[model samples]
Target: MLRLILILFLCGLLASCQYQRPEDARVQIQEIEGQARFTIDGQVHEIKGLAGHTHLQEAHSIGANTIRTYDTTGLQSILDSAHHFGLKVVAGIWLPKSHVPWLYKNEEQRVKLSKELAVLGRKYRDHPALLSWCLGNELIFYDLMDFDFSSTYNRLLDSLRSGDPEHPVGTAFANYGHKAILNFALKIRSLDYLIINTFGRLPKLSEDMNDLDFLWSKPFLIGEFGENGPWETEWTKWGAPLEPSSSQKAEITGRRFKELPREHPNFLGALFFNWGWRHEQTDTWFNVFSKDGERSALYYALAKQYGDSPVPEIPKIKNLKIDHGTNANDFWFESNQWHEAQLEIPESLNQDSLEIRWSIRTEDWFFLKADSPPPLPDLIEYASDRQKIRFKTPGKAGPFRLYVSIHDRSGHFAAANLPFYVVQ
Candidate 1:
C-alpha cells in the first residue's frame, strides 16, 4: 500500500512539471519597405481579415488570415475555430454603453470592468490564435466629457496591460474627425494601434490618414470597411434611411479593398466590415452574408480580392425592385398586398442549372439588441432561373425586405435584397 501511494504521487509530480502554461503569442507591427507589416512568430504576417462571426473555415478558405469579434461572448469557440483554420483573432471587449452617463466616474463600474478584463486576459492571453486585444468598438460614440473619456480609457488600458504585458492594446473609432479624441488617444502610452471603422469614407482612407500625418503617431488598421451605411444616407421624415442596393454595395466594397493597400502603405491591415448577418437599420445593409447563410455579391467580390483560387463565378442581380419601379429604392407596400418582384439576372450565366430562390421577412433591426428568434421568410415560389415572382405580403404592419438568391450546381451563389415598408 505504501509503495502504491508513492508511485501515484511520483506520477502526479511528473505530469505537473511537464505541463507548460502558454504565454503571450501576439502579433507585432514591423516597418517593411516603408510599409507597416504584421510580424508573428518572427515572420512578416500580412493581415487579411474579416469582422464579425461566421464559419472560420469559409473565412480561411477565402484567404483571410484573421477575424475580429465585437465582444468576447462565445469567444472560446471563436478562438478554437480560428486556430483550427490557422487564423488569428482580434478579441474584442465591449465597453459601457452611452446610456450610463457617469460610467467613467463610477468606481464600481471601473472595478467591475477591470475584473472582467482581467479574467478575459488570464483566459486567453496564452492562446496561439490571439493577435491583439481590441479594447472597444467605437467607444467614443457616447456623449462623455473629455476627462471622462480619457480617464476611462486609461483605466481599461491599465487593466488590460496588467493582465497581459506582451500583447499590444487597440481600440476602434467611428472615424478620425474628432481632434480632441484623436489627441487624447495619442496621449495613452499603453495604446499600440488605432483601429478605424468606416463605410463610405474607405475609398479616401489613405487621403484621410495623410491629412492626419501631423497628429498621427501610432500604427493603424481599417477595422471595418464595407458598403455605404444607411445612417450616412438621406432619410425620410419617418426616420428610415435610404439604403443603396446590394450590387452598389458590392462595387463600393470591392473598390475599397483594391485601393487600401495601394493607397495606404503605413496601414497595417484591414478587416472587411461584417462576416455574419445582423440587424442594423436594414437587415441587409452591412453584412456580407444573409441571415439564411446565403453569400451576397460582396462576398464573392471580397473572395476574389482576397485571392480565393478558382473563385466562384457568381451571377449578379441587375435589378431587384418592387412593382418594377424606375429604380431600386423608395419601395412601399401594404399589409397583405400582392406584389410582383422583377429580377433581372445577367444574361451571361448558364441558365439551365441556375437554381433560384426568393424570400421575404420582417425587417431584422430587433436582432441587434438581443438574440431574438430570426425572422422567418414568407412562402414564395421556388423555381429554376425565374425572372419574375409574385407573393403576398405578411399581415404584420412593419418594415420588411425581399431577398433573392441564385445558385449554380458548382456550389457558387449570388444574392440581393431590397427593403420596403408594409403599411397598415
Candidate 2:
C-alpha cells in the first residue's frame, strides 16, 4: 500500500512538471493614465455565430480588431479569418465539461484533463494573433449554478497560467460578475481580467460596467450584452411574436449607445454577443448578419464605436452543390495571414459542379489528403487544381462563408454554405 501511494505521488509530480508556462506573459492592460483610458489595441468581437452564424466579412466590415472563438473546432477558422483582416482572435477551449452528467467515471480523469489543459495553453502560448485564452464559456451551470467557487476554479486558472504566461486568461459568464465567477477571481486576484454577459434582464446594465472595480477590486470587461430575445426590441413574450417593429429594435438597442466608452473609467471594452446571424424560436434577435448576407443594426452600431469598414455587397451564385459528408477531401491551414480559398473539382468530379448568374466568394468544404504537399494554398496568389472544378481564394479576415445557390441546368435552384477556418 505504501509503494502504491508513492507511485501515485510520483505520477502527480510528473504531470505537474510536464508542461508549464510563466504567468507574467499576459496582454498589456491599459491602465488609465490621464484620459482614464488604457491604450486600446483592438475592439473585441464575439464572432456572432451564436444563433446561426455570420460570414467573417461582416465582423471585419464592422471594424472588429479581435474575435472570440469558443472551442478548438470553433476557433480554427475564426482565428484564420480575423488574422487575415489584421484582427486578433481569442481561443476559448473548455476544460472538459465539468457538469457532464455521467461523463468521466472518476476523479483521476478530471486531473488528467487538467494536466492536458496546461499543455494546451503552452502549445498556443506563442501564436502572434492569439489575443486571449478563455477558461470556459458559462461553465458554472455545474452546481445548480451556485458553482463551487473554491479549489476547482483555481485549478482551471492555474492550469492556464502555468501553460500560458502571456495574454489575459479568463472565462465568459452568462450572468453578471457574482459569486460564481468572483469565487475564482477574488481568490486568484491574478486574473488578468473578468468578463460579464448581460441581456435586457439585468438592472442598470450599462451603469453596472463602472461598478465592476468595486465588486472585485480588479479589472473587468463587458463580454456579452444585447437587447431582449426574439431580438426585436418590440418582441412580445413567448408564443406572442409577430416580430417586433424596427422602431422597437432601434430604441432599445440605442440604449447600448449610452454604455459606449464615452465616460466609463473601469470598463475596458465591450464584445457584443455575436458577429454572425442566428434565429431562435420565432424570435430572431442578437445576430448581426443575415442568411441572405445582410448586415444588422448592431454591426453598424459597432462600426460607429470603432471605425467602419463597409462590406462590399456579396454577389450571388448558381448551380453549386456541396457534397455532404464529414470527412471529404478536407484540407486545413493554420497560419496567421490573409488567405483566399479556391478548391477544384476532384478528378472524382463525381461531386456536382460549375454554375451560372454568379458565384459568391464561398466554396464547398473538400477534405483534402493530409499528405498533399506544397504549391499549398498558403499565399494570396497560390493555386491548386484537381478533378474538373477549380477554387481560388484570398487571405484576409476570412473564415469567409460562401453560399452556392444552384439554378438547375434545366432551371431549378438550391443553395448551401461552405465552411472553413484559417488558423493564426
Which candidate tops lDDT? 1
The parts of candidate 2 lying over 4 Å away from their true place are 1-26, 34-54, 95-105, 141-149, 185-189, 201-203, 206-215, 230-251, 308-424
TM-score of each: 0.79, 0.56
How many pairs of residues in model 2 come into backbone collision? 49
TM-score of candidate 2 relative to the true fold = 0.56
**Best prediction by TM-score:** 1
Question: How well is each residue in 283-392 modelled by candidate 1, as lDDT tens digits?
Answer: 56777776767777777777877865554566667777678773434566678878788888778877777877777766655425433225556546544438788878
Taken over the whole model, the C-alpha lDDT of each candidate is 0.70, 0.47
Q: Write the per-residue lDDT of candidate 2 for residues 167-228, one digit (tens) a residue.
A: 67767676564545444433333556666666664446445444554545434556666666
Q: How many clashes does each candidate structure show, in the order listed? A: 0, 49
**On a 0 to 100 scale, what is the lDDT of residue 242 in model 1?**
59
Flag regions of model 1 displaced more than 4 Å. Answer: 1-26, 98-102, 141-144, 234-239, 242-248, 261-265, 313-315, 328-339, 348-355, 359-386, 391-401, 407-413, 419-424
